[model samples]
Target: MTVRAAQRQVVTERLAGHLLASGLSRTSVRQLAAAAGISDRMLLYYFRDKAEALGEAMGHVAAQLGGRLEAALPAGRRMPPERLLAEAARIATEPEVRPFMALWMEVIAAAARGEAPYAGIASEVTT
Candidate 1:
């Protein structure tokens, strides 16, 4: 990738972390720009709009989490069902997993309500 493209990906990931920390609420463009250390115009330049920016950020967050999960699984070894369950339980109790688990539950609840954005985001992430 070009240097500019790589730089943008890094910037987007930093923005995604901020967005994920806000829970289910939307962050204003000004807030996002400030958090990103850029002007609102620059933020808009990278994204079509706030919703599109949020979608990209959240998608980045999900991809990050999926990478973590993939890293945890062994390459070729077959894990026993009981061992898998035990590892799963351990992960659920981990500090790193707590926020994600909470966020996922919130999304599931929101999806049940048929809410916009999140309902679709949740479905996309899960699938």
Candidate 2:
């Protein structure tokens, strides 16, 4: 990867952790930059806009949750959909996964409000 791409990925990972830990309430540009240990201008330099940055970070968060779920509930089972869902629910409620669930609810709330990026992002992540 290019140096710029590597740096952006690092920032995106940091932003993912920040979003999970802090939720949407503390996600100002300055706050995100602070979490990533960069200037606000540098955050913008790595991403096209706040929406793009947030979308990427949220995608990272989703990937993380997916990894955890996959590890907990491996695929290739022939269980019924209801059973599968029950297992997923049990796994999702674990302490380590709760932050991602909280962030997901926040995103859904934002989407319900017809907020920019979030509506689109939520749809993308759900599917």
Superposition error at 4 for model 1 (Å): 5.3
Candidate 2 clash pair list? none
Question: Which prediction has the highest lDDT against the true structure?
Answer: 2
Candidate 1 structure lDDT: 0.74
Candidate 2 stretches with Cα past 4 Å from truth are none
lDDT of all predictions: 0.74, 0.93
Write candidate 2's Cα lDDT for 12-115 as tens digits: 99999999999999888899999999999999999988888999999999999999988877877578889989998898898999999999999999999998
Worst 10 residues of 2 by lDDT: 69-78
RMSD of each: 2.4, 1.1
lDDT of 1 by residue, 1-119 (tens): 98766766766887777766766664788888777788899888777787666667777878877776777765686799999888878877788877667767776787899876677
What is candidate 1's TM-score against the reference? Answer: 0.77
